[model samples]
Target chain A: MSSSSPLLAELIDALRCLPGVGAKSAQRMAFHLLERERERGLKLAGVLEQAMQRIGNCSRCRNFSEEPVCALCASSSRDRHVLCVVESPTDLAAVEQATGYRGQYFVLLGRLSPLDGLGPRELGLHLLTERLAEGEVEELILATSPTVEGEATSHYLVQLARAGGVKATRLAHGVPLGGELEYVDRGTLAHAFGSRQSVE
Target chain B: MSSSSPLLAELIDALRCLPGVGAKSAQRMAFHLLERERERGLKLAGVLEQAMQRIGNCSRCRNFSEEPVCALCASSSRDRHVLCVVESPTDLAAVEQATGYRGQYFVLLGRLSPLDGLGPRELGLHLLTERLAEGEVEELILATSPTVEGEATSHYLVQLARAGGVKATRLAHGVPLGGELEYVDRGTLAHAFGSRQSVE
Candidate 1:
């Protein structure tokens, strides 16, 4: 740190806040910004500040939005009776991009990790229950992830949906398309085999 | 992109300005900054702006420094007569960290890449020659990288130094310490064998 200027040291320390960026990577990033792309660096600072100040969570869906209601939740074209639950906003975006589903979405914000002090409350299950209690939602689709925490969160929510007299469903687990059976994990292969459907 | 909020999209685009960061990594970084470390993100923006505005080339060695002359060049104890020419400030820092060399440094800022239109002027070789003409410098150490461009630059500088009646030296090329003979590249092994030093 003594080898670099105070400005450089501060930039490097700030860059380290980025996920997966270590000390060496931070230094390289700082140098790239300072020496190679100063204008872009300045623009990045402006955009970061503006975005941070303007962005917030959608009050209902828990996805990112500048306003209280996100675009997806506010849209009339989306099916209000069907709701998709996901572990994060990124997952919600991926689903929207890759699928033809036109249902409303509720982002869990994170999966339930009781060990990390995350539970039903952290996943915003109370808000979800409130939404379900309104009696408008008929189907709850769980799309959290394929991980243990995602499964546990889905299980908890499925019970909540059933209690509210709503149908609860989850994404089907199977071998990925174009995947070789030999290369697939044993658990996934077994699950796919056990859940086999008749070919039409 | 259409599904994400405007605030989120702007942040992701800004994050893409970072070196080695792509669209997916940019999205992940944006989400992490917005959802997990907003305060640090704000601080990072501030630090980036401040560093971009303040840091510039050191007047003497052309390395990064906030002051007119860098600490290494300005220090009273360092030998002004022995100057080490390196490709970048990072190289200068590495030499200082790994070696006991007590010499001043001259950063080339780049190397002689003729195809990319880089030549003596681009590498600040004219300024270096002017410094040599002052006659205070007794030796010029060529510490460019081991690439083709670096070798060509070093050879050119050696001729410049010799014309000015100043001694020129280069970092020794050899098999790296702790390197396995079986794994060593052919070029390095040949260089080490050709420059073999006699035992006392």
Candidate 2:
């Protein structure tokens, strides 16, 4: 039956905004949460509230963390001298899942879209310049996707790194056109990282 | 990345149990709830918890309701003498969405499944006899789907209603073979209701 409570309907509508969820699926999820074990559902709500309240971007690499620095940046085993630039924390996660990367990551948080008014300055290019000026980062790996916007982001980063006197390179080609990094297999990611080429 | 936080992961797992939700969709929803507005997410949780805690089977019809008697059952406009019987609350809602019937409903809560050890006794068939004995219901409509199990449930209910001395009928022949009532459009449902045939 149609929900008598408008609050319940609003909540379900909010949930429907999540990727790939439609009205019927959202209704089922809402009903399951409301009509089954509610404590478990509330616990999830608590987690969401806590994460939104506490999670922040790492000052150094921009991966989400509870502290000033992310776990990867804080780890001494990772090579700080070879920084890998990526588009988002989600992409950084896919790379980490591959388990072959032992380098630091610099997440852009978004790709350049000039038509959408997104440019280097808006994407924290100045902060990246400051990080490069710290003189520890020597080799910079561009691991953004092969998409038009991703390519533009990588090229801009390469110019920024070169101007700052750091060696800049893009990950080796093999990433299919229009393919997201999340869809690439771990082995392909490892191969791409191993065969990275200089971006002249 | 797969959610590292146990609480968030549990919630996501629970959400994924809803029909049509996959792992990727669950992950995306989990992230949205965690990263976006916490209040909205928590409100959804609260709705779920409240619904499960407060809503339960309607005393008169056995359909899920926030009150002792469901809105449909208590409504002055609805035909109290006619009751549409269904297998579950989801099925009840499906019929209501069709908007062809202005009568109330009686949800069986489950169908008879002898193979799964679910018989009429297990599905509260005894309680149905009590309602039929009240003698207010003039016509009983079998709105249950045409599935093997659904047919079995309908057959059993028809026998019970006949012995109770009530006029009983099954929703008409227009419904597609092996098709569920939830998938049928309102027009067909209206037509089916208008052409309902008496059941032996």
Candidate 3:
């Protein structure tokens, strides 16, 4: 028996564009969409298109939103004086979900990747500069990833903040919660040891 | 930052219906669709709807197809005297992909599970019986799974074929090809030892 029809094969190929979906998973997803839940499949399509249309870059923070200014940036309860810069909306969401941050966020949308043609301009660094020049922010916390690109972006932002007369800080790096000492890398272990906090 | 917009959240939820897709994977898929592959995402939806509408059960073999009689049953080169019964279209495709089997197939669509109310009628056993009575099938090959339900279904099928005056056969089972002896289970080891064949 042939594994697929033309339409189904096309659908499977398209499904491969999704992150982490390989050929086998794409096939399974295509079969699932065709055989069991056509309604849900169609709904996903509608939602994708709707989201693309409704969710544009937030003018202030570069996060996705339905309007020019997102609800988070428009909220009055958040301290405008404290700004947390994250690499992506997903990272910002994670920090928010952890529930300690009451500051506003500026999403980089991407990190500086010179090889990939993603520079400071590509990451909306000019817009960030404008925000910094506004002088409303007193503290800038860098929450980018610990990767090389993330570190470079964070360093660049820290310098930019200092030049704008704002205090700059970074999220701490160390062994993760419940992580074993044996599994910690040499660089991370050294950093953690150097930055040890006093119990008092 | 909020993790999702309403439309994006809906897409993520809908994507969870696929096999192996959990909350995190669904979220990633939703982001991939909205941010990178909007066209492909929309194309998947269209193709899914089209395939669902076009593909139906083949009248003869009960496999999914765009027509009543599938391409396989409509083919003139296939042997009509031999039939391979399988549990699903995916299984049928797998056997075809493995090669060497050129006979026609009868798809059960499902197996017998009384607890779930999937009885003989649900598995189209009566239709299988009718096909056996037509007398064109000289050999009925059972290719259902080797689970408990699969064993019961195979036994019922073998008995039904015998009563219909047709020769019934099962695929050989034992240690898999190139399998490690130490990993082989006791029952399979016993069966392999008992059924050892001559090298000559």
Task: Identify the leading candidate in terms of DockQ.
Answer: 1
lDDT of 1 by residue, A1-200 (tens): 35547778788999998999999899888878876899999999998888778888899999989889988888889899999999988888788878999989999999889999998998888999999999999999999788888888888988999999999999989999997889999999999999999998
How would you order the candidates by DockQ, starting with the best? Answer: 1, 3, 2
TM-score of 3: 0.88
Q: Which pairs clash in the backbone of model 3?
A: none
DockQ (C-alpha based) per candidate is 0.64, 0.29, 0.47
Candidate 2 interface RMSD to the true structure: 3.7
Off by over 4 Å in 3: A1-4, A32-39, A52-54, A197-199, B1-4
**TM accuracy, model 1:** 0.90
Q: Indicate the docking level reached by candidate 3.
A: acceptable
i-RMS, every candidate?
A: 1.6, 3.7, 2.7
Q: What is the DockQ of candidate 3?
A: 0.47
lDDT of 1 by residue, B9-91 (tens): 87788888899999889988988888899899999989888888888988778889888877777888989899999999778
The window of 10 residues in a row where model 2 chain B has the poorest summed lDDT is B1-10
Question: Scored by CA lDDT, what does every candidate get?
Answer: 0.88, 0.75, 0.82
User: Distance from true position, residue A62, model 1, in Å?
Assistant: 0.7
Least accurate stretch of 10 residues (summed lDDT) in model 1 chain B? B1-10
Residue-by-residue lDDT tens digits, candidate 3, B1-200: 34424555666787787788898888777666766776777666666656756777887888877877887888888899999999987788778878688789998988889999999988888888999999999999999998889999999999999999999999898899888999999989998999999997
- The pairs that clash in candidate 1 are none
TM-score of each: 0.90, 0.78, 0.88
